[model samples]
Target: MSRQNQGNCDHQKLISETDTPSLHEDANTDSGDWFADMFADFEPQNTTDGSYRGTMAKIKATELHYQAVFEQKLVEANTNLKRERIRVTIKQTGNSLQLRATLPLKPGDNSVGKQKKQYDLSLGIPANLEGLKTAIEESYELGKLIARHTFQWNEKYLGIKSREKQEIKTIGELLDTFEEKYYQTRQKTITSQNTFANYLSVIKRNFPLTHLATKENIEAIINSVQGNKKNELIAVTSVLIKTFNLGFQLDVKRDHVTPAYREIPDDEKIISAFHMFEKFALSRKNTNISDEIDTWEMWRWVYGMLATFGLRPRELFVEPDINWWMSTQNIDHTWKVNKNTKTGYREVIPFVPEWIELFDLRNSKPLNILERKVEKIASVQNINWMRRDISRWFRKVGIQFQPYDLRHACAIRAHLQGIPIKAAADNLGHTVDEHTKTYQRWFGIENRKKAFGEVISQRSLIELQKNEILALRMENETLRLEVEKLKLLENV
Candidate 1:
């Protein structure tokens, strides 16, 4: 029941459609809301369910192709320091149609951990079947994830054949292999590994295994992602698909085994992914990563930079500007845009005067706060990792966070500050129509926040009474003195 519906039956309650934010610096709309509102309940299909019946038919035909080979099976147990034997009994559950490893811990641990255990996943596997390709994708996917996570933590898998046994696999198989490998070694920033991860996930969830590229699968996967992911996906997929079109090139590369695999995902189906990020910043706190940073200040910085500014970790080093906005603002209490914004294209965000002052102070600091957290940056392949790490820290302090939640929060903040559609566009360097059209979803929360600014947000902010205010005043005075000294020197 957003102000939009006013009282319109909660506007797709089951789907929990996201709300809008304020205008951009306006930066942009609030949420990305990319996916179509596909809120159909998971009604178990009887024979009469037409869509299920058809999907089942297709699934049966596809499963007929694979000959699932269960290489080995065993249960492994470990005794904790408490001398408690955490024995996990594994079983190949569900009909042979799918192999689901029933863990002793059912409904699994959905939290941050030392070493992430693997979940036995059903990759669109049918309920019951026979000679139809022995559907063990679930087991296979689980094994791969386990091996991958184990390798990452440098943890040992004493049980049966780890994934080191397999060498040649299809594109989908290759990606799952890499995701585990990349996660294990803690290599997060690499583009290819992440790209492959997205590709495989989409394929696993939506597309069938008959082949790498199909019209429907491509469209479906495309429809799966929206916004920045859509753009990035498009950029990567387009390049590869075009290469895929080069038949001889693709063949030669296939023969030689090079970096020329172009599994083209559909463009039209690529939804605006920004909406997917709505909410969750203050959800699912990650405790492990919290142990890494000294203060929540760093998390706030990360949130402001990414969620508020849309600056990637790599883009943190924007060139110096006239005011030299290293981080915050200056003497006259105004924010400064760094020359890094030299290409000078910002949309949906504006260099507010107060913000300028904030950055002016930040600018005075050394150019490399990054030195403190290189390890963290080095492992940032997926933004989700950052979210988890931050969430972990906040959770330890009793806060919730979801990955990329900051970005969403920032977008919402920008819009709420009453940033115009065009300024918001300039702030983000995106288009304006988007700002106007999504006026509701991306703007709702922001609108609410703006509508009731200090009452909620400034509550804790008001905690900056006594010496905290003194510190700010002193800082501002110091800048003023420095400016005076500079003036005298110029006059001399």
Candidate 2:
């Protein structure tokens, strides 16, 4: 018989032998004999009770032998090859084949690490040996074509359907699509929109949209940049991952990629920065009485607002709608955070009454009491620029500090004042655990020890009270029993 005709007979025989009622009844006998013959040269390390498992083992061994023979032929065909190899495997699904072709690295490969990767091609093919052999040969040829282009394979090369080809978009193109979807699907605040725009700009600046979608390019870009620039690179990579995930929902083929972030330690200690900033703010208020009082007062309010409310620097100056600031009839009472906050909406009351007076709430349109009319609503860039000016001022006064340090100072003050950790976190619009992790050192060892001692003392007192209650109960029971006996004796 021809190989194709014999394969057809074998397929029919396999289905008949496995599924027929009479064969199933005598499966142990018939299948064991069949598997023993098929795997005569192969030995199974572990024993199986059923004939089905044994048959499967024999089939697996046969497939491995077939793959090994094909691999040996490829090796013989290419004598000087070092690392490249063709791996063929039949899918367990019974109607598919898989081919993996690894391309050897060139002498000057610019990949970050020396890891072997391959181009995989999967095809639906018949289960018969002859059909599998033909599919494997076709896959080998296709893999060679892919390798010749340095593994930059695309759907066009494989002649995939147009629908499938449309899914294979470059990373940059997918990001643009993702950004469009983001604006359409999400209700973005002005701050959020600005942040998204910045992320898009950074990604486009660093990566070309025309390049193929691969993680290796991301790695190379990250490696090419160093120092502070790496932070921007990592930020871009993070946005890319988010964009790709969004693209996935639209059937785009941009896989997620992660770029490693450099872990640079903070040099400015929170407590030290706080003290220095406080002195600077106090000096501004105390020293200049005549010409610069307005300027000094503005800095004072800025410092006080950050320290008192833990407000972000930009929050104080963001577009001055009524939502930005709220106050009660008096400056001393708790105020509502009427606007959208970074960690969602939260209310923060000042510790001191003077903090609230920093805002000119008498006017229907709230403005900073110290801000000029023209400067009432400052842009985010101007806010940041002012913060830099404040930093320089601190240096001129022989202090090292930034505007953000005041917020940290607020957290530390909250810890020192014996505020409940959860309450403090809520006031700052953060979780208790996050608040603790960020400012645990500022809480001081003595505070931690005091907290620990209080807990231990409370537990000890509870145990002592429990013991006393138990002893009293026992005494009362004894007295009751004696009284009952006396009553019985009197009745006798």
Error of 2 at 400 (Å): 1.8
lDDT of 1 at 148: 32
Q: Residue by residue across 1-492, what tens digits does model 1's lDDT show?
A: 478785444334311211111210111222112111211221222221112233344334323321121112122111110122111222345432323332322233455543344334333333321111223222332334433332222212222232343233343543444444333212122333444556556545544444455334444555566654444444344433432221111111101222222221111111112222222333434545553333444444443444435443333433223233432443433223332221222222333334333422253232344334443443324343644565564454443333234333444455666566566644543345433533444445435555577566666577657569899999999999999999999999
Candidate 2 at residue 163, lDDT?
Answer: 36
Steric collisions counted per model: 83, 0
Which residue runs does candidate 2 get wrong by more than 4 Å?
1-179, 204-213, 223-238, 241-294, 319-328, 352-398, 441-492
lDDT of each: 0.36, 0.50
For candidate 1, the 10 contiguous residues with the lowest summed lDDT are 73-82
Clashing pairs in 2: none
Which one wins on lDDT?
2
